[model samples]
Target: MSDPVRCMTVCRVCGKEDWLDVLSFGPMPLANNYLAPAPSYDDEPRFPMDVIVCRSCWLMAIRQVVSPDVLYRHYVYISSDSRQILNHMRDVANLAVTRFHLPAGSLVIEVGSNIGTQLEVFRSMGMRTLGVDPARNLADLANARGVETLAEYFGEGLAGTILEQYGHPRLILGRHVFAHIDDLTDVINAATRLLDPAGIFAVEVPYLLNLIEGNQFDTIYHEHLSYFSVGTLRRLFERHGLRVVDVARFAVHGGSIVVFVGQAESQWPTGKAVFELEELEVRSGLTNEVAYQRFAERSGRTMRELGALVRGLVSQGKRVAGYGAPAKGNTLLNACGITARELQYASDTTEFKQGKVLPGTHVPVVSPAYAHDHPPDYFLLLPWNYAKEIIGREKSLLEQGIRFIVPIPEPLVVSNESLKDAAFSLSHG
Candidate 1:
């Protein structure tokens, strides 16, 4: 079935009607849509991915609409599977406990929680944890692992049910989930209602500055409705009588900001980080159309360079297999016109993705063990943001003269010695 593309006539942040077209990735497949082996190439569906920025608020968003039910009903990603993500969650859980001084039985709730990665950390610390998620598989898995989860979409109505069942929570959180939602007002209202008067509500969003500076245009997809800046985020919360009390930046998912929100009447003072980041966004022209225009130009250049490198290698009879079959990878592959002929297959760590095929390009998905049995001459790091962890995990391949090709930020080849040196620098420095 084909998905519908609807134009967003109003700015989600400020309720303004003016929006400027920024970059168009053309028609692309749903980033997480992995195909069965029997499905023919013609059966695959592709939707338009036109990114636009609000002239009033400077928020970047994909106006093309696709139903969340079609995108996340049977999601494949499990946060605990990624080592880096698990570590980050642990760090966050610990900080929440210490910084907020959460009691032993304090309630912690995470909306859109995937496999209870963060909740599990809190549960281990003797805190009562609950996960609210829509993916049935993930919800069931989390329940089996002792993290009680509700398998339903979250909103104002659902928040009432939670409030009636479980008392107001001390902490409410979401990671990389807010941007995926279309109705921000409902979600924020729900969180505000369920939070204790003095409780903290935190969310992690991929930073817009990092996306533009790193040339990560492939991150745009139907699922992510908004590209937020601190200024826009602050405005959104202030409109709902919620105050952003703290802002912490981290290098996860390329780069992200963890924003802590509380009621407007709460005594917690707003931190300097929020204002500092807002100033940075203004100075960097993050809210301007010209910045996005430059980003589009860089994206085109990256597509040309990546295509030439991979196709040139294949033309010389060299084998190239991709590592990490992420949603962003599919965007890059389709936008760059890369096909199975150019790169033999993509390898992923998740067992569910093994044997499936990436959407659009028909690149077969296999296990990382393939690198040992049928090692490619050059391995393409699809999830280039985790280059350090990936290089360290596959150091054996590096030792075997398997040079890695990182395409984002800049296209470059990493030799064995260079990979070792880079890993050492990352670990030591």
Candidate 2:
């Protein structure tokens, strides 16, 4: 008999209580990266791929499960892939050290330090640094760069070991890693234990408001077990003996919030930005199911419009392919009901994912070189946040006659010639 099909109709955060049937993105496959059908794995199971809102807490999450080991191991995503990110990290590192007045030899520990990108910035500042990450290849790679990395999944046990061996960290940082852990209790407890009495925990996650307001349903894939708003975060951290003191919005990953946390009883006043978010959540009835129902309604509409636009292009005999093979792209593709047949392929600069196919859709990923050699009629920029960067870099290809298509907010068609010199222009202006 085949494995039983699992479906989710309730809220995960509040369990069965205040269960709100928000929005369903319909059936989507396991979108970490599509694996090929091999004799060793003849028939693999796919999840329900539905995301529901907890009417009680208003937290949004996927309704399926993927082993953490399989999700993170042999990871392909790298932090240093974009030039914009490099600059962002540089500024963030300098700001962090100066704002906190981090003394020399003060420990700065990063959880999910992918390839040691940000920590390397810290090392340049003469600070003691440690990276705790689960991915074996990434840990090995970080170690190769002379950055001390522990290849173990982080929890209370790892925190215990760290406290025993290295003492408490002055700064604990996690970017895009905070929402990855489902069992937040263990990691939050571990972080509290690993923190110095006066230590600060800095986390960057996609703000739940932005995810809803901007229609970023793609961020709700299997890897992300929780979507956090300031309200939800306040309750979560306080329960774990940690206090969230500040929140800052960043342009990275579409729109993200960097929350600065400390021990729960600490006397730090909440930042104005944090208060603004809290009030926003209150106005939206963040703890109620009504807001989620409205958000879900709009999201389905957006997805349909996007799908119609793409399909219209296909019906016109235009050759369309995608740019930037991102996890968010999986959600966009899935929401738009895009099959491999609709998009010829997606080109990624990341060598690790270049040759591998997309996790569930089976859309092959190619290098930017593939576009140069076999230019298509349209280049669909799925990671539209980095559209300006990608479009600028691929100006040479546009010079050879390839058009750029951006699908966010709404589908817009633009040319590379005008945007080719944009980064420099933005810098000078």
List, in order, the clash count of every candidate structure: 0, 3
RMSD of each: 2.1, 3.7
Please provide, for model 2 over 1-429, each residue's C-alpha lDDT reduced to its tens digit, 9 standing for 90 to 100: 333343445544344555556666665655665554333433544566667666666677766556776678777777755788888788777766776678988899999998898998898898899998999898999999999999988899898888888988889998889888777777887888887767888888888877776666767777787788887787777766677888877777777888889887765566788789889878876766767777777777778887887788889998889888888888888777886778888888777787777766667888888866777888888888787677667677677677777777556666655556552232110
Across 1-429, the per-residue lDDT of candidate 1 in tens digits comes to 654556688888999988888888888899989988874678677888898888898889998878888888999978845778878888788877787788999999999998887887888899898899999999999899888999998899999899899999999989899999888999999999998877999989999998998898878888898988899899989988899998888888888998999999997788899899999998998877889899988999999999989999999999998887988899888888898888889998888889999988889999978756888999888888888787777777878899888888767888788855763343210
Task: Record all residue pairs in model 1 with backbone atoms less than 3 Å apart, i.e. clashing.
Answer: none
What lDDT does each candidate get? 0.86, 0.76
Name the lDDT value of residue 428 in candidate 1.
12
- Candidate 2 C-alpha error for residue 149, in Å: 0.8
- lDDT score, residue 104, model 2? 84
- Flag regions of model 2 displaced more than 4 Å: 1-16, 36-44, 284-290, 396-401, 416-429
Q: Largest lDDT belongs to which candidate?
A: 1
